[model samples]
Target: MAERRVFITGTAGFIGFHLARLLLAEGFRVHGYDGMTDYYDVRLKQRRHAMLAQSESFTATEARLEDMDTLQRTVEAFRPDIIVHLAAQAGVRYSLEQPRTYIEANIVGTFNVMECARAVPVQHLLMASTSSVYGANEEMPFRETDKADTPLTIYAASKKATEAMGHSYAHIYGLPTTLFRFFTVYGPWGRPDMALFKFTRGILEGTPIDIYNHGDMWRDFTYVDDLVRGIRLLIDAVPPLPEARGGSVPGANVPGDSLSPAAPFRIVNIGNSDRVRLLDFVDAIEAEIGRKAIRNYLPMQAGDVPATWADASLIHALTGFRPATPFREGVARFVAWYRDYYGR
Candidate 1:
C-alpha cells in the first residue's frame, strides 16, 4: 500500500477528508481533487485541505469535477491504482431551489469521472451515493437489492441516475465498481447544512433549531470516522469479475449481496444501522453542550423523509466491519471539537 496511489474526489468534503487522512496514515499516496465550491463555507473546506496538505503523501487540485479536462488531466497524471469519486452537489432541500446544480455537478461530473476511470482501467472505482435514493420506499431497513424507482427530489434522482451509469460503465468496460449509499453522516468537521452542526450552533448561540416533521424524524446517524473507515476497508474488497465468479451470478456467491450479474459492480450501504430519532439527536446535542435548546417545530420540509434506516449487513459481510459508534458519545466528541474550533 505504501507505493499505491489513490485519486480521490471531494477530499475537502467531510467524509473525503477523513478517508484521505486514513489512507495517508496507512502509507498510501493520495491525490485529492475538489471544487471547493461555496455551497457551504469555503473556509471549512480550505481548512480540511490545509490539514491534509500537512501530510507529505498528500497533494490536491482545486477544480470542479464538472471540468472534464482538469479531472481527466489530474487522473492521468497521478496514475492512481484506485479512484474514489465523492464530490457532488449535496443537499436534498437545496436541490429544490438549485436543481440544475445537482444535474450539472452530480450527473455530468460523475460521467467525467467514469470516463477517466474506464480509460485508466484502475484496480477499483468507488463512488458515494446516498440514502436519499431510497426515496418513497417505506421499508424499515433499506437493503442493497431493493428497487429504488421513485425519487422525491432532484438530489435523489441524480444519485439514482449515477448508480445506473456506474453499472453500465462497469458492465461495458469490466471496471470494478462500488456505490455506497450513505445515511445521515455527522461528526466534527461536518457540513454546516447538516442537522448536528446546525443544532449544535443554535444551542450554543441560544437560537432556535428547526425540528422538521414535528420532531418525529429518524435517521441512521453515522459517525464520520466510522463511515470513512468503511470506505477504507472496501478499497481492498474490490468486486471480482464475473468470469472469476463462475459466469456472473448475482447473490450466487454471497448471501444478500447486491452484486450485478453482468458486471463487476455492487452497491453497499455505509451507515450505523441504528435508527435514531431526531428529537433524541437534538437532545444529545443539548446535553453535550450543557444548554437547553430553543426548539422550533415545523412541518416536514419538501424533499425530506420522516426517517432513514440502512441495513449495513452487506458492508460487514464484505469487509468484516460495522459502524458501532454510539450517538451520544459521537455527539460529545463533536461538541468538544466545535467548542474548540470556534471558541464557542
Candidate 2:
C-alpha cells in the first residue's frame, strides 16, 4: 500500500528483530526503537540491531518506552503510519523476581505508546500479548473471548491491562488496533530466555537442561518466519467495526477461540496450532545437534502453565494462512543458526 513507514519497539528483541528485517525486505521503511536493557545479553540485542542497520531503509533509536519524552520525540521523528509495540520487560519467571519492572515497562510503557498513537493516529496499531494470559484456564485451546481474569504472573497481568487500555483508547479515539497473542515463538534470533534457546545453549555447553513438569509441558511452538508472515497479513486486516453493538442473534451463543466482538479491536493467536510435548521439543534439538541432552526433571516453575495450544482458526480465516513450520524443521534451522552464530 503506499510504501508504509513502520515503527516498532523492541527491535533488538527476538520477534521484533525478525519483524524489522521482514518489513525492510518488503521495501517498508522501518524505524526500530529499543532500550537495549541488559536483562539477558546486551551484545545479542546489539547484534540483532547491527544486522538490521545494514538495510538502507532501516533506522533505529535507542530509547526506553518508560521515557515518554524521548519516546515521543522518536515517534514524531519517525512519523510511522503503522506502529508495532513489541518492547516490554519479557519473561514470566523474571516477572516474579522483578514485579515493578513489569509495571514500568509493560503497563506504563504501553500507556505511553497508546498516547502516542492517539496523537499521531495510525492506519493500524499492533501490540504483542502472550498465551500466558490464559492463566489457570485448563481449556484445550485458548480463545480471545476466554475469561483472562486470573493472571498467574505480573507480566501477564500487565499485558492484560494493556489490552484493556488499548480497547478503551480504540473505542474512544476510533483507533484500529490488533492484538497478537503469540504462543511459544522460537527460531533464529530468538530470545535467550526462551525454552528453545536455553535448551540449545545448555546442550551445547554440556550442561543439564531443566525439564519442567517432568517434561510433560506442551507448547504451540511457532517459527519466527511463520509468526512474522501472520503479522504481515494482519497488517492490512484492520479490525472491522462490530456489526451489532447493542444486541446479537446469529453465532452469538458460540464461545471458543479468541476474537473480540465489541469494538473495532480484536485479538488473534499467531501460532502453529500444533501442540508438541516438551520432551519431544528437547528431542528435536538433541537430534539436530546429534547429542542427547542431560535432562534435570523438575516440578513446574511458578507462573508456568502445563501446556499452551493456539486455536488459530480466526487467524486462518483472516489471513488465509497458518504457521505451517513443523517443529523439526524450525528447530533444525534454529540449531544451525545457533551453531554458526556461536561458532560451535
Q: Give the winner by lDDT.
A: 1
| Tens digits of per-residue lDDT for model 1, 234-333 | 9988888887785454333777999998999999999999999999998888888889999999999988999899999999988889998999999999
Q: Candidate 2: global Cα-lDDT?
A: 0.88
Tens digits of per-residue lDDT, candidate 2, 282-303, equal: 9999999999999999998999
Which 10-residue window of candidate 2 scores lowest in summed lDDT?
A: 245-254
The alpha-carbon lDDT assigned to residue 282 of candidate 2 equals 93
Model 1 misplaced stretches (Cα beyond 4 Å): 247-252
Backbone clashes per model, in order? 0, 3
TM-score of 2: 0.94
Residue pairs clashing in model 2 are 143-257, 143-258, 144-258
